[model samples]
Target: MEQVLVEEYRNETLECLHRGHICGVGPDGQVKYEVGDADFVAFLRSAGKPFQAIPGVRAGIKEAYELTDQEIAIMTASHRGESFHLETLSHLMDHTGLEQSNLVCAESYPMHRGSREQIIRNQGHEQRVYHNCSGKHFGVLSYCKLMGYPLEGYEDPGHPVQQEIVETLSMMAELPADQIARGTDGCGLPVFALPLKHIARAYLKLSCPELIEDEKTREAVQKITAAMHAHPEMVSGTNRICTTLMEDTNIIAKGGFKGIYGFSLRQEQLGFAFKIVDGSDEEWAHIVVSILEQIGYANQQTIHRIRERFPSAIRNDAGKIVGHTKEVFHL
Candidate 1:
């Protein structure tokens, strides 16, 4: 528990922290942890993005909105807020008849410390549109326009866009609307809060969409999964782990709003979900690295490349990791 807390409680304080979060599902389709109720509910934040985009995909606006697969992949993303990030998001906005100034997301800087500085030096101001969730916000706008739903209050849980999202997610988890808790997302939209098990179930369902009786939903899932694998780099960005791993492999990979991470291992017909005890975006390396190791994706060269892309730092006497963050993940 203390080890997990180490990632969650990075900011030192006097209080003893008792709270923690979740990890992957066991073979039995239940989460394997004890810190929180394995079945307790919480918001998926951006983690629910891909699932939310399902309705839009089903409505047939991918190319009509001029969306690429990578755009579609991170449309469900909490992106890194870099230049390509800005381009894709801005393009999505223009495609939907919204202005760059219309975005309401609270400003978020790049998760990559290096990239954040570079972006700021180039732009000369803080930018909310460049925030990773911007693509998602643009997506909501597109969904509203394409579906003829009011863009006003579209982010509200009661709005048609969110309603479609809820229905799709609820159906995927085999739960009803009331069984899911709805909350506002970082992007100012209603996000679903479900049990970790159900979140895992959603990924499993994505990998195994044949279980979905809805033909349109099932077909859309297939298309999104195919596109994610086909254009992994676009889904994430250059040198990003999600982009690298998903592009190189057959998994349907996506990172969620906060610290939630999920993927569907297509060949194995399995899926995984983990919510970092803290919503630290950097902790993604720890969780995903640990998962790759557990799932036998242990190629030395592959792991080496992956680690270099998002190296974890463990400090020594001076709190420096020699040159990199030492990967430490225990399943």
Candidate 2:
């Protein structure tokens, strides 16, 4: 069952509420705290990018392409198509010899406000290269090229690259491949569905790769997380939750298209996954801040930064105070 996690107040009266499930797993891989149905199953969405890029990393794409940390980090990004993101994508393509035609993600303009407006002012058209998932697609295509796999119909679930991605995610989540549900993503790639608890476990694995028994997988996880931490901006963009949370080196975090998010606290040895029942992302900051506060997170500065970037106070068109969002759940 869904529980109200956040409430929006207008003129001191409750105007709306956000209901969701949150699952937090301790170092032992057991659910330590939860609200609502911790067992709720949902699609991982872009939250699965880190694991999706693992196969490419394990295949030595970094070494083969001499890719920088920014390039590698972007592979796991839901970039906002800022200028920096476009530059990094170009660099990644140049290094790997990947063309825009190789990407199967839908055409779109930049997701960033200023960038989109700039494009519109110049009468620019939508482009596949500007799609947020283009980096993820590029990583897969790079893997296919290196492995001698066919690029045609690469989005098909039966493709070897896609199969490898599923297998990699299974290993990371500590769940059998057969037990994990699957569907196509908005970007034409397969999306994974798993319980919230397993999602936390997967993020925990990313944070503490030492817990992994397989050396190759462990190494890949380390590189991916490190890249994310080293270049947080490449992971998302300015003021984005993923970028903000990852700015704290101790935290490895990512969010999906819907209201889904996952993160791990390295020092605390805890992982958390949460989703808004209505698929709204508006309350993400409030929920995340509440979770950190409830958990007694060590880095107060990171929490402060998140609040500053995603303020709870609402403002009207003339900048007058209107309403505020409040976290209503504990743990």
Candidate 3:
């Protein structure tokens, strides 16, 4: 069920007033518990990053082509467009003798407030690296270079890269392409369309591809997971939610804009995907932590720690501190 409520309360400590929208995925992995349709069609967004990074590893390009851990990390990232991320992107392009003109993504601002001012003051223009999906674009370039696929139409749905990704996801999820919610990601490549449950299944399958019938799919999953774990930082940045989520809890998690998150734990072999129907991303930490708890990876103590580390929005007004969200479900 999906739940959204308008509740009035006061924050006794901070003394502020505010409104709240709370949405979550509990330990049981229900798509929609309280409100409904939590399993509604979901895009998976950059959460699909690892899937896009697979071809490189499955083909043994990582071993024979000597791809660095850094490159592998970048391949699975939704970076902050920091100086370091941009530098790496440029270097990756240099390896292929290409430049900015080749990117298919629309230009945008930095995801990290950390680099916004410096970018403006120095460059007089927002750089493409700030688009957050630049590393993904660079990954496409790397694939094109490796497979000798024509670069001009690689971003189009009919291209070989898109076809491979679709085929891979189709076989892995045991679903047909038409059933998947295929769409153009913000970064200018075809992204699989799926409901939250299927999205979670995709991640879990990555964690345990032996469950999949295809041997190549199993190897692809293993390679991508190892590469991501080896270079966690490039998946996000210094303290990004995805990067920290991966490093701290040792879970494979990625966040998408407009409130979507997915993760899978290979040992127990479970999966989870959730979305806030009303489209709220501010409560990302709460959603993720609660999901982890539901999966048995965290207890009350861990929940308390995560909450303290990332406080919910509460404000104190005339009488009480107001809670910022009302996602009816709890961990």
Best by lDDT: 2
Worst 10 residues of 3 by lDDT: 14-23
In order, the Cα lDDT scores of the candidates are: 0.67, 0.92, 0.66
Q: Compute the lDDT of residue 298 as modeled in candidate 2.
A: 83
RMSD of each: 4.4, 0.9, 4.6
Residue-level lDDT of model 1, residues 1-331, one tens digit each, is: 3244323223333222223354455434566533344565667876677787788888887867777776676566667775666666666666667765656777767765677898678875666776767777776677778878877777677787887888889888767888898777666778788877777778876777776789999999987777767766656677776776675455666776556767766555556666655556666665666567766773556566777776655445986543333334445
**Candidate 1, run of 10 with poorest lDDT:** 9-18
lDDT of 3 by residue, 109-173 (tens): 77777677776777657556567887777777677767888878888988888788877777655
Off-target runs (Cα >4 Å) in candidate 1 are 1-37, 107-123, 298-304, 310-331
Q: Count clashing pairs, candidate 1.
A: 8
Cα error, residue 132 of model 3, in Å, equals 0.8
Better of 2 and 3 by lDDT: 2
The lDDT-based order of candidates, best leading, equals 2, 1, 3
Q: At residue 34, what lDDT does model 3 achieve? A: 24
